[model samples]
Target: MISSNKLIAAISLAVVGGFVAEFAKPQMPEGSNPGYMTLISAAVGLCVGWRIMGPRAGRDSSIGLGMLGVVSLVFWGLAVFGTIEMLRLAMRRRFDEPVEALEMIVTIALKYGQYLAATPVYITLAVGIVISGYVTNFAYRRWG
Candidate 1:
């Protein structure tokens, strides 16, 4: 079984990696097909998660790791985009269009969910998190 602390650490790394990737993604050239950032993020996610899991995982734990990766990606996306939305809303204070912070955050989060679901690059990266977990487990067992 994956220890709770290790699992949390793995998820934390993935979420932080995702945040970094999202921040840099915007500055990338339009024609650039995501470049190495995706690979780096995946590698970091895989290595850290595998390392923290401590060299062995059962079938159930392996699956759980992948699921955790997915869950963390959702969190990462929410955090990155939600921050942007919060800032955008926070800056605008139109007298006629009063907005509640809670409501705006919720609305923005929903929109971000939909946007991420439809975005191909973002989807690929999210899926990469799952693959990274599985591959990391395999690599660590065979070679490490």
Candidate 2:
């Protein structure tokens, strides 16, 4: 029994993340839309938090779910954008120079981490992340 308000906030944040992705236009081909990745990531994160925490019927659980949903947004943003950028780098062979297969893999791993650590990932979710936190904080304080 997920809280309706929390669900709505989660969904809205996903949508906001999508808009960010669409505008960011990092590695996507011209006219390509990468928004769906953010959408899917947010949905998956919500599901994951719901599944692990179980029904949100209980007061404690509802609060937990609310907080989890907010945190999940961060994870989703990082993972979805990071993977997309990493894959783009790999596909374009954007490394400084050609390398052995094993080296390529290692370099990709490192770059992936760097992408995750980059500012744009957080920027994409900037306002939305704050909104999520406020939503959850409200949920916990008001109802949970």
Candidate 3:
């Protein structure tokens, strides 16, 4: 069922994703083309906010919900991008073994994480998620 809380959560996280993507863009290796990175991250954020954080919005403390949102966003974002990179590499026959290809997904994600950690992306995400959780909680209380 649709709810104001879910909608708010989705929108907030989507913005957070876009911000993080923009922040991370400059940190990417030189000569990398990050076409649609912001859009993809926002979409991922919308889905995760709706599916994961939305339902739990009112049930948990705002802080707890915010932390959950941040964790979910980071995990899904990394997983999606990592898998995409892995697939690109696989198509180029960069991995001789299937297992190595699968491993590359994690390796790529960790590398991405390193870049994110080195920047202000984490701070932006944390602040955004926390505010999102608060707003979602308020919506739940006001509308439900």
Candidate 4:
């Protein structure tokens, strides 16, 4: 079993790595495909999670690592788009008329709707991580 200090270091490194990827995103060429970035980020996240979390003594943890990567992607994707949209809305200073207000509101709603369309992936990643963590912990205590 890995020591607690080592585990914490791994997790910290992973989180920092994840954030680095996230922050470097905008510096990447605009118009580049975001899907590709997402995949790369997920891969990085997985590596970090796995490195930190480690595999149980004799069990494969590859699947769990992959799930963690996916979870990171989903969580980050939502956060990125949500924050951008909110910033855009916040930056807006005026709506010309009732109709304009309605239009702006509708536009914002539509953007949010599209953004939230990926909810299943997010939910799956979230539930998978929680369940996997619990199972890993349980297995470690019971079987290790």
* Index of the highest-lDDT prediction: 3
lDDT for each residue of candidate 4 in 1-144, tens digit (9 for 90 to 100): 454422432443344434444444554456844444444444454554455444531243535643554445445444544454455555684655656554565565444335333544345445545544554444455555
**Model 1, residue 71: what's the lDDT?**
55
TM-scores for the candidates? 0.48, 0.44, 0.94, 0.31
How does each model score on lDDT?
A: 0.53, 0.51, 0.88, 0.47
Best by TM-score: 3
Which pairs of residues clash in candidate 4, taking residues 3 or more apart in a chain or in different chains? Answer: none
Model 4 score (lDDT): 0.47
TM-score of 3: 0.94
Worst 10 residues of 4 by lDDT: 4-13
Candidate 4: deviation at residue 73, Å?
A: 0.9
TM-score of 4: 0.31
- Candidate 1 ranges with C-alpha deviation above 4 Å: 1-60, 94-99, 119-130, 139-144
By lDDT, highest first, what's the ranking? 3, 1, 2, 4
Which should have the higher lDDT, number 1 or number 2? 1
lDDT of 3 at 75: 93
lDDT tens digits by residue: candidate 3, 1-144:
999888888888888989999999899899999888899999999998899988887899988887888789989999999999999999999999999999999999998887687448868977986798899899889995
